[model samples]
Every structure is written in C-alpha cells, then in structure tokens.
Target: MEPSSSPPAITEPAAAGSGEPLAHRRLVFGIVAIALLMASIDQTIVATALNAIRGDLKAELTWSGWTITVYALGQIIVMPLAGRLGDQFGRKKIFLGAAALFTVASLCCSLADNIYLLVVFRAFQAIGGGAFMPTATGIVAEQFGRDRDRAIGMFTSIFPIGGIIGPIIGGIIVTYWSWREIFVVNIPIGLLLIVLGLRFIPSSVPKATSRIDGTGAFLLAVTMLFGMYGISSLGSAGAEPTDPLFIVAMLIALVLGFLFVRHANRYATPFIPISLLRGRGFGAMNTINFLFGAAMLGFGALVPLYAESRYGIPPLQAGTLLTARAVGMICVAGLAVFALRRTGYRAPMIGGFVLVAGGMTLMSLAPHGLTPYAWLAMAAGITGIGMGLSIPASNNASLQLAPDQISAIAGLRGMFRQSGGIVAVSVTTAILNHATDAGTTQAHSFVVFAAILLLMIPITFLVPDHRGTW
Candidate 1:
C-alpha cells in the first residue's frame, strides 16, 4: 500500500472538490454529526434510567445490570468485525445498515414487556451501535482528508458533550414520561441521519483487499461473551469468589482469549490486526484508554449512588445531580478543540487526569450536608474538562498509528475501552458491596477507590503523543 495525497477537509461540498454546492456539504457533515451524537448519547442515557427500568420489569437487581452489560458485550463482539467489514466492503452501506438495525432494536426495546426481552433487544441495539463508532471515526477522517488533526480533535470533543447531555435527557424523559421514552427518542434522529447520509457520505478510498477472519471473529465473540458475563456476575449475591463454576467460566474465557491472540497473529488478516497492537504509541494510548474507561465507570456508578444514599434523594433527583455534572462536561468539551490546537496533548492529558483524580478524591471527602454543592460543582467542572482534554489526545494518538485501517482499529479500541468500563463497574461494585455494611461504609469505600485511581496518573506520561497522518 502506498501513501497517496490526502484530500481537502470536506467542510462543504466544494471543499471536498465535489460537484455539490457549499450548502450541500455543510448539510452533509451536519447530518453526520447528528447521527454520531445520537449513537454516542444512547450509550450514556440508559445509565440514569436503570432503577426505573429494573423496577418496571420486576427484574432481580443483578439481572437488571445486564441491560448495560449485554449491550456492551454485543458491541465488543461486533466492533472489530464492523471495522474489517467496513474496510472490505464500504463504510456508507454498513453504516446505514447498522443505523437501520439500531432503530429497529430501539423500537423493540421500547416495546419490550419482559426483562429478558428487553435485554435481548438492548443486545441487538449494541450490534447496530458497534458499527457507528468505527465507521463514524473513519468517516470523519475521510471527510477531513489530510487535515485530520484538527478534525479529529473536534470530532472527539463533540461526543463528550453528547455524553454530558445524554444522562440529563434520559433523566428528564424517564421522570416526566416513562423509561420507554429513552428508546423512542432515537427514532426521529435515526431517520434524519439515514436520509442525509445516503445523500452525502462519500465513497471509501480504494485499498488493499483483505479476507474476513471468521474463525478469529468467532473466538473473539466467545471471549467477550464469557468475559462480560463474568464481570456482570461479580459484586452480586449469587457469585461467590470461591465458586467453582464461576472460576471455571472465567478461566475458560481467559484460555480462549489467549488462543485467539496467538491464532490471530498467524492469520493473513487477524480479527484484531496485530500490526495495530504493535505500535508503541498506539498500544500505550489503548492502555491509558482502558484505565480511563474504568475510572469513568467508577464515576458513573458512584455519582448516582452518592446522590441517592447521602442526599436521601429519589431516582429523579439523583439523576438531576448527575445532570449538573453533564452540564459541566458540555461546557468544557467545546474548549477542548482550541486546547488541542493551541497546546500539545501532554499538558492536557496530565492535567486532565489530575483533575479527574482530584475531583474523585474530593468527592470522597463530601460531607453529609447541602452546603457541599459548591465543592461538587467545582469537582464536576474540573473532571469534565480533564475528560474532554484527554479524549482528543488519546483518540488522535490512536488514529495516527492506523490511518488506513481506521475503522477496524478504532473498533478494536472501542472493545477495549468498553470492556474497561464493564470491569470497573463490576470491580468497584464488588468492592463497595464488600466494604459497605451501611451508608458510612459505602462512603469510606468510595474514598478508597478514588485514592487508588489517583495512582493511575503516572502511567499517562508513558503514552507517546504521536500525531498520525491526516
């Protein structure tokens, strides 16, 4: 494969050197951004609605959490495959198909009458969503042509704002209407993206043909399913640390994953593509991303727990406190574009992690009173800024290493990041469960967790700030 000249940034149709007018080009990218926001927001929206969803379905507490796990597990299995599929076939077709699948699944989720059915539908929804991340990243890269540094920076920043808004919207809808409204919201957004995408998303640049690694895909699926199930089972009453069945299942998953890695290296086209993993900067960025994912989950799970437990707030109020945090994230995410452009990533990554660690640590120190709102707000703002800043740098590093195979590699990165979230939730929940006999214990346990996460700061510097080609 030879390096060809990069295309111009496709801000408008003329910028893309297309026959279309400037208005049409802006219309195209605007629609793509909307589609991207819809998909990313859905990932976080359901977080705030878990309690209502579980109660309505009369699900066991442990089972209700699977609503999150099942969706992520499905994505873990499908993301890598989507990357390769998009690379081999075409990004636009797979993207549209995935969007349609996502819309259908969301409708099914809205209509679900049973907990089991809802979980199944959510899994299907993830299969659709898994494609969106990689394909969207690839599309952004393609649209920007060679000027992807700023484009990637802006692209990465937008999703954090979506993450910020999702919980608030989910909370409002579930509070005023029903949990079903969460899924229903995606319909109009999905339809709009589909129509616009068909009109504007460009054809993929032709590349070397690659075979689909079916065996590797199957093994990867097995690995993720068992791994996620094991994670979900932890911190729950039914799964004991010494349980033989649980131990055996975890061992099996590990064994299969090891085999998959070994086999993938030998294949002509590995499911994960070992070449991507070998890049020093890329590998380090993923490691940091995995840890960051875990920290994000800890914050995600802890915020609601604290709002409800300490403040004696109801689900809606607990969710609203989370909304405050989202508002902070939205404010900071926009600044990230300028930050990445003006200064290099090192200062921001280090500073961001420090802020997150500081914020989490401070939250650990929250007193049992209303006056702490100031401290809470400060913490939320700082953490959000840190997350916003760190994300663009990490994503930029990952893209730099694998420009040609952006979709596939990005998908694999998503799998690791999401898996990190699953693990963090499971492990932190387990720790809290073991440590918390009461409210005080829960608070103390959280402080301990936050302190430990603070230790992850030194590792960030190990990541190289490689600015990959546009």
Candidate 2:
C-alpha cells in the first residue's frame, strides 16, 4: 500500500468571535465534552437498570443481558468505521449525524415494549455514542495543538466522570421513576448536543480519497462479534468453556481476524491502518490502555452487584458507592496534568498502575462477613485515582506519538479499551457463575483483575516518556 501524497491535516477553524482564541477553544471543548459525556455515561448507566428492564419487558434474564452486549457490540464495530468515515467525510458532519441518531435511538429505546426491540435501539444508540469519543478527541487535538496534553487530559477525564456518575444517576432515576427513564434522560442531552454541535462545531475538509475496504471491515466485524459474544456467553450460568458454540465462535473469530489483517496489509486504505500498530510508542500505549479498560470496566460491572449482595443494600445505595471512585478520578486527573509537566509520563504511569493493583488487592481481602461500606468506597477510590492518572497519560502519549493520525488512532485506542472491557466482563461473569459462594467469587475476580493490572506496570516501562515540547 502506498501512502497518499496528501494525508489529512488536523487544522483549526477560523475564530468566530473577537479574536478570543481561548473562548473559541472553550466552546469547542464544551461541544465535544457534552458529546463525550453522553456517550460515556450510556456505557454503564444501563447496568444499574438491567433488572428493571428485564422485569418490565418480561424478558428472560439470560437474554436481557444482550442489552448491554449489543450496545457494546455496536461500539466495537463502529469505532474504527466512525474514525475512517470522519476522515473521509467531515468530522463535523459525522459527529452531528451520529449525535442525532443516538438521540432518536434513545427515544425509541424508551418506547420499546420488548427486550429485543430495546436491544436493537440500544445498538443504534451505541453507533452514535461510539462515534462521539474519537471524533471529539480529534477536535481537541486540532484545537489545542501545543497544549494537546492538557486538553486531552481534560477530554479523557470525562470518560471516568461519566462512568462514575452513570450508575448513580441511573439509580436515582430508577428509584424515582421507571427504568425507561434512563433512556428518556438521554433524549434531552442528545438533542441539545445536536443543536449546539451544529452551531458551534467547526467543519473540516474530507482528508481521504481512497475507497474504504469493505471486505476488511466485514471480516473485522465478524471477528469481534463472534469473539465477544462467545466470551460473554461463558459468563452465563452452567456455561462450559468447552461449549461447542463457544469453540466454534472462537475458531471463526481467529480465522476472520487473520483474513482481516492480511487484507489490511494489502489494501491501499484498510478499515484500520495496520501500520499504526507497528509504532512502538503507539502500540505500547494501546496495550496499557487495554489493561486499564479491562481492570476499570470489569471492576465497575462487578462492584454494584458485589455491594448489593455483600451489604444487602438497595440498588440506589450500591450505585451511590461508585461516586467515591468518580471523585478519586476527578481529583487525580487535575493533579496529573501538572505532575506530567514536572515529572514526565513514566512516574505517573507506573505509580497509577501500582495504585490500581493495591486497590484491587484490598478489595479481594475484604472480610468474608459484611464488609463495611467505607472500606469498599476507599478501595474503589484508590483504583479510580490510579485509572485517572494512567489512562490520560497513555492517551496523551498516543496522541503525541501519532499526531498525524489523530482520529484513526483515537478510534483504534477506543477499540482496544472497549475490547478489554468486553473480555473483563466475560471473564468475571464466568468466575461468578461457576463459583458456589458469592464472597469467594468476588475475591477471585478481584485477584484476576489485579493480576492483569500488575502486568501493566512492567509494560508501562516500555512506553517512551515523550513529554510534549512545551
């Protein structure tokens, strides 16, 4: 594959105001942040409302889990496509279209009377939500060229902000209203984003002239769908790792994945540019990002259930506990931006993983009897702080390393993170399903999460601490 003579350059739009660049940048940030928050919050908010959805829809417990699975599937499948599309079309156009789709989908989700219908609507929602993150990141990269680290840090921080708040907000809404309210809430947020985004978001010229690799895209989608679905299935009750369906899905994923890679290497412009992965810095950052995703998202799924079962707390109370984790992330992110300027990336990256490992270990060792709520909150807070530090550091490193491929790399990074979340959910669910006792299951899962995080500490050493030239 030959490189195009003219690759897309990330450029800033003309200022609309009285030469106030800061104000213009802030407007751009606000537009992207709102889109990012809407997308990120939807990822976890549904977890708290799953039971309510199941009961109201009269859906089987086993099948109802597809609500989350399908939404994730949409995200995994569309992220790369969204990035490529934004590059081929205009980022502003793609962002607005996606945001509109997400808003309409949310309305449809609230009206769905059956679980299957709700799941379908959720996928549409995911399509819009997934596109928002990478595209928004791309905008930040262009708008804050020299200060991309600080801007990226602020943008990346919204992910945990939404993650921390989703369940709490979901719980409150569910407690006061109906489960459908969860979807209903997104309607206003999404609509407002669409209106504001069209007015304020800057337009960019399409960068790519190459035709998309349809075959490569299809093959890659097949690999992710089968692989993720198979892994998630393993978490079901009485599920066997050796189940025929699981084995078949895994086999198919492997074969299709190989085909996709081969096709990508040959195609002029593949769905995902495989060359990006060859870079040591980009590759290493993605690997650590994957681990972070698994630990953070996986533990997030387990905590509410763990809290509810261990303490006999109501769903609302259990969800509220997640606020501690959010608070930790917010606080660390602010400090990390300053710390990175003074210390560079290596210290925070290593220290962040250490904190994550320690927190998970603490959670695993919680007393078998009724664990104190304060103890749970503290452990979660520690883990959140670690996540807040590491994720942005890694993301900033990736952006700095591959400034030319901002949207594409951002999408790729998202794919890795979401994939980790999928795997984590699957692995933990399987452990929980197989264990006879709840406490033991939770401990085993935490240990597994901690072990994965510990691997990141060594890997972080491999990441080049390229402090941006201020």
Candidate 3:
C-alpha cells in the first residue's frame, strides 16, 4: 500500500474546462459504475434461475446453493490479495486483468454442459469479479482525495445501484432467452469496460515495502472457509452445531485460523495490515459494517425467493420487485453527496439505518394474498436509502482513517462486508429452511428479514458524526 503522504495521482485528465466538472466526474463515475454493475449483476443473474440450474444440473438443493456460495467464497479468498496486487503492480493492470478473466468466465459459464463445469467457471468468474470492487474503490480514493466524502458517496452507490437493476435485467435475459443468457450478457459489457478502463484507470506504485504473506493469506482463507461452514451449519438445528465430528473439525480450523491471523500480524505481510485495526474509528465502522453486511446479504437473496415462491410470480416479475431496491439506491445515491454536505455523514447514517429497520418492519406485516408490489416497492426503496447512506459513510470513514494505506483499509472493509454477506446468506438459508413448511417459506423469510433489521439499530450508533479528511 502507498503511504498517506503520497498516493497515486488520477491519470485521467478532466475534460478540460468543459465548463462542467460535475459532468466530467460523472463520466468517470459512470465507467466505475458500469464495472461494478457487471459484477453485481452476475451475483444474482443465476438467482432467478436457481431452480432451472438445479434441474438442468441434476444437483440437489445443497449443491445448487454452491452456485452462489462458491462465487462468494472465491471472492473472499481473492479480495485481500487484490488490494496488494493493485498497489504493487498497478490498479489498471489488475482491474483490466480481472475484467478480462470475468468476461471469459462468463462466456464459459454460458456454454457449460454440466453443473460441475458451471461451478468451476463461476469460481473463475469470482476470482475475476473480486478484483473489481476493491480496485474501483481504490480508484475513487486515488482520484477523489480532495472530495473524499462525496467520492465515497458516489463510489458506494455503484454496487447497490447495480444490484437493484441486476435482477430485473437478469430476469429479462432468463425469461426471454434462457438461464445461460444471464452469463452471456456480460460479454459486451465486459469488453467495453476493458477498453474504457485502459484509457482511464491510472497506473500506481506502492509506497510501502512489504513481502506478500502467502502463509498468512493461506491461513485467513482457511479461517473464513471454516467460519462460513460453521455459519452455514447454524442455519439448521438438523445440521447440529456440536456434532462431535463437525465440532472437532471446526475446532481444528478455528485454532489454525486464529494462529494464522496472529502470525500474519506479527510475521507475514498480511493482506490487511494489523496496524490499521488500531484506528478506533475505522475498526468500529468495519464492525458495524459486518453486521450490516449480514443483514443486507440475507435480505438480498431472500427477498427474491419470497416474491417468486410465495406469489407464484414469474422470474421477470420477481426481478422487477428486486429492481425497485436498486432504483431506490440510485435515487438516494444521487442525494448522498448533497446529504453529506448538509449532515456531515452522522445524521444520515442514523437515518439510513432507521429507514432500513422501519422498512423491514413494514415488510413483516405484509398480508398474505395481498399484492406484494406496493409493500415490496416501499421496502426496497427504503432499504436502498439505508444502504446508500451507510455504505458511503462507512467506506469514507475507513478510507480516511487510513489515508496512507487505502488498499489495506479498503481490503479489510471489503472482507468484513463480503464475509458478512456470506454469513447472512448462510444463516438466512438455514432459517428459511427451518421456518418454512411446504406452504409458508415465503412468509418465514420475511420474518427472518424483520428480525435481522431489528438487530441493526444499536450498531448504527457506533459510527461517529463528525467529518474530517479521513
């Protein structure tokens, strides 16, 4: 990671006195937004088609879940390394490389004749996809150092905005074409990003000298996998947490994982520098983010399931409901810069969570046989506001706290956020599995989302209200 005293300069020139700085900045944001959109869309492209994937692949429900799990796992495994790679090599090289890999993998995914091949390609796609989120963020930090808060507001909006629209777009592709078309859709977008990225993304060199921590990286990966497995297991009582055999295995993994983190802090050049964790503001923000991540991730997946399974809605309709969330995100995202200017981040942060909690509560009351369109639209939009505010605030806080090491701070935030998603999905899946009879899974899912939303309130206060360069 580069030192705070001197970070990478934005290589792309402003559309010189185009008499519109906002428009020029928006162009850059547009490019980053599109890259993020590609990645976000892929997460759920296979979502509406989960059943089709299961039927075509002849896999059981458990294995079908891996289509999503493997991709997230791949992302978790690669996320930390991306920051280091971006810093050491250059953001443009890593960004373009990841984009290219993601593009090719998408093509492979479309053509896979079997589930095994599809899963493999998905993992490959994730490795590539993982590079994108962090790199795009690092670019924002690099380019918008002067306007840190607004930069984060814009940067954070990209994914949720993408996520909001992805399901709708994905549904269209699946409905009009086939499930495989979801993967195929990325080809043109990916190609364009690669071209745009090369022209715009600046090259950078790391200011700090440190060796890659292969040992620590390996251990962190193991720890996350084990932790995720434990989380996945907790999703069901039938999947006993203390089965002697599973407990023993988990213990071993936990022990090694702990040792790995410790070792990394002391010996290895860890993917996340332990030194950064010492920043009280940054650390607290990240902890809060992890909780937020868990809730948001669970809801992200479970919402679609509810619309499809409970309402007997088709894939496209289900997707439209999900797209509403993104629309809310995009709308709130535009407001974020202005909001930050007025509120200094703290008030909006609290308000965002409040909206989320309130929205989730409203969703819990949705009556059966009622058209979910109205409820879903409100819930999705409100949740987007909560998400839009929280993400930008938390991201800016963490990055500012560690201005010298944007890569490392951004990497850690990404890890916590991604891991939160992984755990949330695992737990939600487990809860949905347990709560639902054949008849009421959809309702049960909402109840779970309500519970998660209720849990986010206290955590929101941990964030500080003041604005600084950090």
Question: Against the true structure, what is each candidate's TM-score?
Answer: 0.86, 0.91, 0.84
When sorted by lDDT, best at the front, the candidate numbers are: 2, 1, 3
Top candidate when judged by TM-score against the true structure: 2
Estimate, for each residue in 11-93, the C-alpha lDDT of model 3 and write its tens digit: 42331112122323444556777877788777766776788888877887766777887888788767777876776656678
The TM-score measured for candidate 1 stands at 0.86
Point out where model 3 deviates above 4 Å.
1-28, 233-238, 243-249, 307-319, 366-372, 436-464, 468-470
| 10 residues in a row with least lDDT, candidate 1 | 1-10
Per-residue CA lDDT of candidate 2, range 1-470, in tens? 12222223334443211222333567778888988888888888888788898898899987788888888888987787788778777788889999899999999999999988898899899999889877887776666656766887887578777877787788889889998989998888888888777666667766676776789778877888888888878878888899998999999999988898899999888878887666677678878777877987778778878877666767766776677887888888878885677767878888888898888888777644545677778888898898778766776777667665677778878888888988888877777776778766787788888888888777777777766443
Candidate 2 positional error at 147, Å: 1.3
Candidate 2 local distance difference test against the native:
0.78
Estimate candidate 1's alpha-carbon lDDT, on a 0 to 1 scale.
Answer: 0.71
Q: lDDT scores for all predictions?
A: 0.71, 0.78, 0.69
